[model samples]
Target: MKDTVLNILVDLTGSDEVKKDLDVNLFETGLLDSMGTVQLLLELESECGVDAPVSEFERSEWDTPNKIIAKVEAMTNEL
Candidate 1:
């Protein structure tokens, strides 16, 4: 899951700077902006088969690869 999210981030940002050990804040890293965030959530929802509300979109949820995995896992569990 982490690898998958990492791949997505890399593809979106055109950067290989994401590391498994590094704490990455997508916004701070400039890997994601407001528009990118929407696109990412949509992709995640499609890929994970989960619906994420825009209101649930939070910076903490997208802070790092691990957090992304956690968010998806939680959303999947809810379904």
Candidate 2:
């Protein structure tokens, strides 16, 4: 799941330099813009089989790889 999310973020950001263990701020790293967040949510839904609610879309949620995995795990558990 972490790999999937990381791949999506990398694709969305159009960067291959993002390290798996690096703590990245989506906005700070310019990895995601406003619209990119929506695209990411859609990708997460499709790839993770979990629908990410707008309410669940938060800065903290996209703060880092660990957070993303946690969020996806939570969303999967909710399913």
Candidate 3:
């Protein structure tokens, strides 16, 4: 799950070095913007099977790769 989220973030940011910083704030670093967030959510749904709604996506909760993985894992566990 971490790998999947990392891959999505890397693809969106076009930065291979992002993997080294798992807890980096993507938004603050300008690595992810509103448009990229939407694209990432779509990829997460299609590839990871974690269909989190856009309404529930909060920057504080899903900002980093680790946080995103935790969010998705929680969502999936609820199903």
The lDDT leader among the candidates is 3
**Could you tell me which 10 consecutive residues in candidate 3 have the lowest summed lDDT?**
16-25
Q: How well is each residue in 1-79 modelled by candidate 2, as lDDT tens digits?
A: 7789888888988886555545777688777788888988899989999898778788866777667778888889888
How many clashing residue pairs, candidate 3? Answer: 0
Residue range 1-79, candidate 1, lDDT tens digits: 6666677777777777765444677788777788887877888777667788789988876677667778888777887
Give candidate 3 regions above 4 Å deviation. Answer: none
Report the C-alpha lDDT of model 3 over 1-79, residue by residue, as the tens digit: 7788788888999997569988888899888999999999899899888887889888888888788888888877887
Which residue pairs overlap in candidate 2's backbone? none
Better of 1 and 3 by lDDT: 3
Please identify model 2 stretches exceeding 4 Å from their true place.
Answer: none
Candidate 1 has what TM-score? 0.80
Ranking by lDDT: 3, 2, 1
lDDT of 3: 0.86
TM-score per prediction, in order, is 0.80, 0.84, 0.91
Best-first order by TM-score: 3, 2, 1
Highest TM-score model number: 3
